[model samples]
Structure formats: C-alpha cells, structure tokens
Target: MAKSNERRTNIFPLALVTLTGLFLVNLLGFIDTQTGSAFGCGRDWPLCNGKIIPEVWNTHVAIEFIHRLVVLADLLLLLFLIAATYRRYRGRKDIRILMGISFLAFSGEGVLGAISVLTDNPPSVLALHMGMSLIAFTSLYLWTATLRQIETGKYQRFDLQDASSVKQLRKWTWGTLIYSFLVVYFGAYVTFTGAGGYFQGWPFPTESYSQAKTALLIDLTHRLMALILFVLILRLFLFTFRLRGKREDLRAVSLQTLILVVFQMLSGALLIITKLNLIAFLLHVSIATFMVGSLGLLGLKASSLQEKERMKEYNL
Candidate 1:
C-alpha cells in the first residue's frame, strides 16, 4: 500500500499532460501568429474591449480567443504541476530547478502574447515570442524526462565502449540543437517579414540573384543555414553509429535526430515547392518543434551520463 501511494505521489501522468498542454498552447500561439487578427481585442488586454467576452465575433477574434483560453489553461495547469512535482520530487535538485524554469517560461510566454496583441507582428517580434515558447517547451520536457528517469531507476547510460565518444556526441548534439534554433528562427524571421514567399523554385534558384528582393536574400541565407544544421545532425548520426552495437538508447536517439533533420529538410523543400502552402508551413514548423525536443533529450541524457562517469572516476 505504501509503495503504491509513493508511486501515485509522483503524478507522472499529470506532469505529462501538463507538458503536452503547454506544447499545444505554444503551437496555438504560432498558428495565431500566422493567421490571426492582432487587433482582434481592440487594444484591450486581460479583457477584450473591457468585457469578459466580446459580443461580436470574427475569424481573428475567434482564433485569438481560443489562443487566450489555452494560455489561461496552461497557466492553471503549470501552477498545479509546480506545486505537485515539487512536493513529490523535492529531493531531486534537477526536477526542482527545471520546475522553476518552467514557471518563468510560462510567465514569459504570457508577457509576449499580451505584447503581440498590443503591438505589431513583425517577423523579428514573432521570433522572440517563438524563442520563449521554445524555452518553455524545453524546460517542461527536461522536467518530465527527469521524472521518468527517476521513476524508471535508470539515470545514466550503462552500455559499454567509448566514454569519450559519448562526451563528444553530447557536445555535437548541443551544438546542433542551438544551430537548429538559429536557422529555424531565421526562417521564421523571413516568414513573418514576408521575405520568402515569392521564390518559386524547389531549392530557391531564381532567375536573377542580383535583382532579388531583400526578403529573397534573407530567405536564401535561412536556407543555407538550415543546410548547415542538417549536416551537423548528420555528423551526430555518424558519431552514434559508433555506439550502435553497444548502447541502444543513445544510438536510438541519434538515429531519430538524423531522421528528423532529413524530414525537416524535405518538408522545407516541399513548403517552398508548394508556394507557401498553409499545411506545408504547419508541417515544417511542427517537425522542427519535435526535432528540437528530440535533440534536447539527447543532450540531457548524454550530459547525465558524462556526469555519472566523472563521479565514478572521482570515487575510483
């Protein structure tokens, strides 16, 4: 009975739900940014037109209202998660610290949303908002992953062979994740700034590069950066292959990371070929979101293993 009670105390399922909800809210915010009425609430934040709910309705208002409701839901759920997880996992510094970061990220996301409603929706502004969303998602993810690790009683890699390779892969994975963010952000910048929709070719080869708009140039740069990011992921994939015969978990992560990067690149190409198709855009962004999450998970796992190895050496 005591063991069951302890198991329930952690509230793993609740934490997972809360994190998933947070992701959905962030995704909704992106959707709203892409197709929303910035002035839907008429310069009135916390309340639309000083009312709990506006009497009139429009496409913009509806989308914006849904996003607001989701954010409110996230706020409520996050508070619950903070209180519950802290109580259950108080002994774990990692979980405690990540929960705090999760709270801060939730606050930042709210602030950015309110600001977006009050001001312009430029690509750069949206990129900042996206950055906050990414942080929130990542913190929650690590928090969740840590809890799962604690519950499973498997915190570090036990598999054989090269410790140095795992360490190097960790560095490479971290670098890839950061680089991916920059490339994706630049892509978003070009997107909201109206810089890349006109290029009709598959790989963005236009008739005259010299006579292109600034948006086209920016778009080209974004693509170039994305290609570089892909190569980095590929390098991580090769590193993982070295451990494929030994450690299944690390190798699996690297494999997924590589696969995601390939699909992301293909999706980006399809997005352009389809001439900025709405579905294609969402697909690209969705894949990028998950790709970041996967890469982040790999980094966390690798770092934990590295720390464990150092502690072992010290004890030895």
Candidate 2:
C-alpha cells in the first residue's frame, strides 16, 4: 500500500514539468506563426504541404510545420499524463479537479488551432489560442507543486494569521500576473496590427503620435505595465527582507521573483532594439511566460510557508 501510494504521489510533479515544457514549445510555435510561417508546410495539417517530406525548403515552411509537430507531441504528452494520474488518483477530488481542467485546456488549445486555420489565420483567434495554452500550462504547474508537497510530506495547513498574510500576498501577486497577461496581449496586438513594421524606427512612429495612436497606445501600455511590475517586485523584495520571522522559503521566492522580473524587462527592451527579430521576439515571449510561472510559484510557496508557520504557532 505504501509503495503504491508513493508512486501515485510522484506522478503529478513529473507530469506537470512535462506539461510546462510542452507549453514552452507551443509558445515557440506561436512565435513561428506570427513570423508568417504558419503555412510553411503548404497548408497541410499533419504533413508538410501534402508530402511526407517537402521537396522544397523554405524558412517559413520549416517553422510552421515544426510547430505543428510540437503541438501534436504536446497533446500526446498531456493525454498520457492525464491517464496516469487517473489511474493513480482516480477517486481523489483534487486530482479529479485538476484532471478536468487539464482536459478542458487541451481541448481549448485544439479548438483554437482549428479556428486559426479555418479563419485563414485570424490574429484574434491566434492570440486567444496562445492565452488558453498558458492557462493549461499554469494549471499543470500548480497541480505539479501540490503533488510535490504530498510526496515530501511537507504539505502544510493554514491558520487565521497565515491565511490573512497569504490573502494579502495573493491579491498583489494575482494582480501582477494579470498585468503581465495584458502586456502579452498587447504584444500580439502589435504583431496582428502590423504595428511593429510601421514605425521603421525604435519607440516612435514615422509620423506624429496622432497618426499612429493605436500602435503607440499598445506599445505605451506594455511599457508602462512592465515598469509597474519592476517596481512592484522591487518593493516585494524589500518587504520580504525587512519582515520579521520571514521564512527561508518566502525570502527565496522573493529573490527569484526579483531576478525573473529583471530578466524579463531586459528581454523586452532587447526585442524592441532588435526591431522584432524572430529570435528576440521568441525570447521576450518565453521570458514573460517565465515571469508569470515564477510569480505563481512564489505565491504558492508563500502561502504554504505561512500556513506552516501558523500551524507551528498554534502547536506552541
């Protein structure tokens, strides 16, 4: 019984990590699509332009076709993880809840892909597709962490004081996460609107602000939110440093958050400087995803640590 339970407990975190890797690959596919590489394979869904292999070689075709392949792989991995989890934790409410979410998210991603192709690659649908993929990634991430705790015998319960602090942190962290999403959406808008190619220069349109208001607005909003996040993370680090009785886990999370935010900001600026080069753009997207994931992990760690501390106090 103990051995079986141990095997079940270990599966969730491993599955979650696999899911995150797949999510990263999918984001790469999105970047490829945005760069006009979606039909690189000549409009073939599972094959390269109706051939097992294409006789003609082109950058766009290679990118688009590879992206499709990656997505297919991701789907397979997710399904396998779900099946394994169900086998192990079929009756547990928490496992069932996460499995349901994972299933729904995978379905949504597939629908988005079909819609993108059917709509002749509509930008709105494509962008929303990427967003839904992120949701699926995040769900798996959370579930994986939960499983890790269970395996390590480190799962902690919350009390009133811990709950209050966590509530406050949750509010701030969630807000930051939402703001990050908006920044990513605006990036998609920049691509869809052809705004990146418009200015022909860095940080300014060729003409006055009034003529390029929409593009300018999108750029400005993303920049401003980035600034806000940087400051907010800086503040969080300071607060964590100053707080009495701060757990090691909380401090570690704060430090990691600060590092990720700085890297994200730098990557964004580099993308601008490179004039939206494909590699730069992908890096920007990847870093943004990383920031979101890190912040989420930090929030969870803080909450769990606080709960542990509270339990300790009560015991005393």
Candidate 3:
C-alpha cells in the first residue's frame, strides 16, 4: 500500500504527460505525411540532405526536420518513463507488464516508421504505420489509467451491482477492441490500395460510380466494416446505459465510446466530402486513435470486475 501510494503521488502525473506527448507526436507524424513533406529531404533520412541542419531548406524540409527532432525527444522521454516504471513499480507485476508491452509496441512503431523513411515511404509500409501507432496509443492509455487504479486502490469492483452488466461490458468491450483494430487496418489498407480515392462520396454517392473490380471491393469492404463496428458499439452503449443497478462508470465509458464512434463516422464522411483534404484526413486518423484508446480504457476497467469476482470466490 505504501508503494502504491508513493507511485500515485510521485509517478502518475508524469505518466499522463508522457502518454499525451506520445499521442501528439503521432498526430504530428500524420500531419507530416498528409502535407507531403515526407519526401521533403529527398530520401535522405536521419539527416536532411546529409546535414544535421539542411543548408538549403524549404517549408517541407523544415517541417520534416522539426518532426524528426520531436520524435527523438519523444523517444528519450518514453525511455525515461519506462525506466522509472521499472524502478518505482517493480513489485507490481501488472504495472511492469504494461510497461513492457507499451515499450515494445512503441519500439515497433519507431522501427516501422524508420523503415518507411529509409525506404522512400513505400505504400505498403505507410499503410501499416498507423496500425502500430494505434497499438502504442492504446497500450499507453491503459497503462496510465492502470497506474491511477493502483495508487488509489479504486477497483470499484464491489460496485458491480449487476453481474449481467459487468459480464456484458467485458464481453462486448473485448469484441469491440478486436474488431476496431481490423477496421483501423482496413482503413489504412484502403488508402494505399487507392480504393477510397476511386470511390467519391461516402455511404451512398450522389449517382452511380464505377471503378476497377478490386478497388470497388476494397472500398466497399472498408465501409462495410465501419457499419458493422457502428452497430456493435451502439448495442454495447444501450446495454451499458440500461443497467438498473449502479453502473454509472460503465455508462460514462459507453457515452464517450458512442461519441467517438459518431465522430469517427463523421470524419470518414469528411475524408470523402473534402476530397481527401489533408486536415480532414488527419482528423480521421486522430479520432480513430482516440476512439480506440477509449475502448482500451473500457477493457482495463472491465478487468477490475473480473478480479473482484475472483476475490469473492476466495472468500476474502
């Protein structure tokens, strides 16, 4: 308990800040990609034009250069947090496990990102970059919330007044988390395949449109995945809110999840309506990141119910 209190008081704020910084840097990366500055340095990575600072510079080069610098700083900060988590919370196996997972996912993202830069940003590589970012973001977000849970010892496990609701929350949240990852990957998949671009407008176009058979299939499948995700989340939200007993926390989670899904759908529309505008595209990715993170939070919270249930069986 003393250790938990010490960590809560000493380390949790830094964790939250680190999580936000990770999220922000990834957002910047997306903006850099959308703005077409990814090639600003002319395929020379780690150094722009073979100089620590480019002697000849333009807007694109400057953006890319600053982005690289920020990434270096972000990596350093994440490492510091990871080391601190190990030293300060080593006794807590759960926290250490989360730290390890976040570190590996983040490292994989960095590797993939570097590979893209060195390889002139291949379409297939770029398509998969955001998927790794999704994993890192979700892992770190869960770690942050878990740290707080450890500090305050607020499992809210005994608050599970309705066994049915907790069961539903756990089951549906697991499903949503898994399904959302596929949706994100397919979202990226459509971009590199040129499927989305070939199909103008979203949901239903103003008139009939035709495209290559493959492109049509990919684009339609992406939309179909989104529709299915929407239905699942909507059903979960209704279940979360309908619990007759005290499940306000789950209700709140449901509310946030529902809002993110709605905005994700809106951003998808904007991606088409704006003709794949850079900012709109960035918005689409940003919302998807947060929406996935929200469900990650739900999964973390849902675990507490299970843990408390086990405690009851132990007659503790």
Candidate 4:
C-alpha cells in the first residue's frame, strides 16, 4: 500500500512534464496561426522557405522557424524518455507497449508535419497534423504514468468481472475522444477558411449567416459530445460507488475523467464567447490537450481491468 501510494503521488508530476511538452507544441501552432505564418516556409519540408537557414528574421519567418525547432525538441524528449524507461522497465509488457506506441505516434506526427508543409499548409492536412501530435502526446502521458507505476511498485493488474459496465465506459470514452478530435479539426477549418472572422462585430454577422452556421455546428457537436460524456461518467461513478472497495482504481480514473471533461467544455465555450482571444485560445487548447491525456489514461485503466477480469474467470 505504501508503494502504491508513492507511485500515485509521482504519477501527477510525471504526467505534468509530458503535458508541458504538449502545451509547448500547441502554443507554437497557435503562434503560427495568430501571426498568419502557416505558409511562411513556402511549402518546404524540413527547411525554412527552401533554405537551411533564412537570412531574414521577419515575423512569419520567425514563427514558422521556431515551430520547427519546438517539434524537434519534443521528438528528442520523447526518444530520451522511451530509451530511459525501456532500460529500467525492460521486463514489463505494459511499459514496452506504451513506449512502442509513443515512438510510432511520434514518427507519424513527423510525417504528418512534413506533409502539412509540403502541401502548402492545407486546412485538412494541418488539422490532421495537429490530431496526430495530440495522439503522440497522449501516448507519452500513458507511458509516463506506466513508468511511475513501475518506479513505486504499484503496478497491479485488475480483475473486472462486470464486463457490461466496462464495455459501456469504454464505448463512451472512445466516443468522447473521437468527437473531440472532430472539434479540433473543425476549429482548424474555421481558422484556415477564415470563418472565425465572421463575427468580427460580435454576437452575430451583419451580412450572412453561412460562416456563423458552420462554426456553430462545429461548436454544437463538441458541446453535445461533452454532455453525453458527462452523463456517461456520472453513471459510471454512481455504479462504482455501488461497487465501493472492489474497484477503487477504476473509480479514481472515472472521477478524473469527469473533472477534466467539465473543464475542457468550459474552456472551449469561453474561447468562443471571448471572440477567440489569445489567452483564452491558449487555455482552451491546453484543456483540450489535458482532456485527451485524461481519456487515454482512462482507456488504459479500463483495458487493464477487463484483462484482469478475463484472467480471473479463466483461472476459476
């Protein structure tokens, strides 16, 4: 129990480290967008405007240029983490799997990034690129948590005999994650399509509602998903309360998910109401990133519980 408590305490800090890296990446992207530097490099892959080093230091050039460096830093950090954790927890399949996923997702993020630049920063491509980065970051969070578990020797497998509840939570969690990605994608679309400027006068567009409608639809879908997820989480928490001592870990994960989801929804709504103000935008993206990480953690907990239950049934 002492070891488990120690691991639980350490997990938050480690997760925060990974979250910091993700926040940096998100900030870089936001800076690029705010400065209209999406095409600053002029369709060059791994190069700044087709040169290893640009002789100029214009705003667009600087934003795009620095974003590249930030991505490089993130990649290196993830690689170092994988290497260090694998060396220490070489025998653990869970840790190995998490590391492998993180590496693969990082590689995919690099490819998507290159494609975004090569395609002249197409909206769809850019959106997908951000989505891929989020996946990589989520994997890193899971891996970091797993490493903490190993360090404190709190890595116990679960036995979840009530498969129905497990299945329900899994479905809801997965659905929420997917819907959140779509929200991000549409947000990118709004920026790239310049639809975000529709309400320049605030509240409503004076001329046409087309742009407003599209943005509203995107926002509404995200909001509906948030509501559904909240209900699902509340139900899960209530069920866990009934189960009490039997599923303490699962209950903890459920509560965390609920808290993060609520915050994410609020942040997103505030961003829009504030007219996409820079500070709110940053916080909005940060909360969304946190939500993704939380969802990933919940998924892992659920899967582990299911596996344990299956093993127990087989042994019986």
Write down the RMSD of all candidates, one decimal each: 3.4, 4.4, 3.1, 4.9
Write the number of the candidate with greater lDDT, choosing between 1 and 2.
1
Question: Could you give candidate 3's per-residue lDDT for residues 1-316 as a string of tens digits?
Answer: 1222543465677788888888887887787787778877767767788888899889888878877887788788788888877786676555666777888888888888778777867767887787888888888887788666665656444454576667767888988999999999989878766667765666864333354566777777888999899898898788877763476677788779889999999999988888788888888998899899888777766665436533543334
Best TM-score goes to which candidate?
1
At residue 84, give the lDDT of candidate 1: 81
Candidate 1 local lDDT, 1-316, one digit each (tens): 1122345435777788888898889777777776756667778898876778988899888877777888888789888888887776675566767888888878987897788777776567788778778878887887787667655545443554576777788888888888877887788888787666767776665736665657667877988998898888888777888777676677888789788888998998887788777778888888888788889888877875435533443332
Task: Give candidate 1 regions above 4 Å deviation.
Answer: 1-5, 8-10, 154-161, 305-316
How well is each residue in 149-256 modelled by candidate 4, as lDDT tens digits? 445545444444766776776676666667666666666666566565445332233435464776655444445655666676576667556655766777787677
Clashes of each: 0, 1, 0, 1
Sliding window of 10 residues with minimal summed lDDT for model 1: 1-10
* TM-scores, each model vs. reference: 0.90, 0.80, 0.88, 0.77
At residue 293, candidate 1 shows an lDDT of 82
Lowest summed lDDT across 10 adjacent residues in model 4 is found at: 1-10
lDDT of 1 at 308: 53
Top-scoring candidate (lDDT)? 3
Query: Which residue pairs clash within candidate 2?
Result: 40-61
- Candidate 2 regions off by >4 Å? 1-5, 9-13, 43-57, 90-95, 154-160, 197-207, 210-213, 242-245, 302-316
Model 2 TM-score is: 0.80
Task: Arrange candidates by TM-score, descending.
Answer: 1, 3, 2, 4
Model 3 regions lying over 4 Å from their true place: 1-7, 152-165, 206-209, 304-316
Q: How does residue 27 of candidate 4 score in lDDT?
A: 78
Ranked by lDDT, the better of candidates 2 and 4 is 2
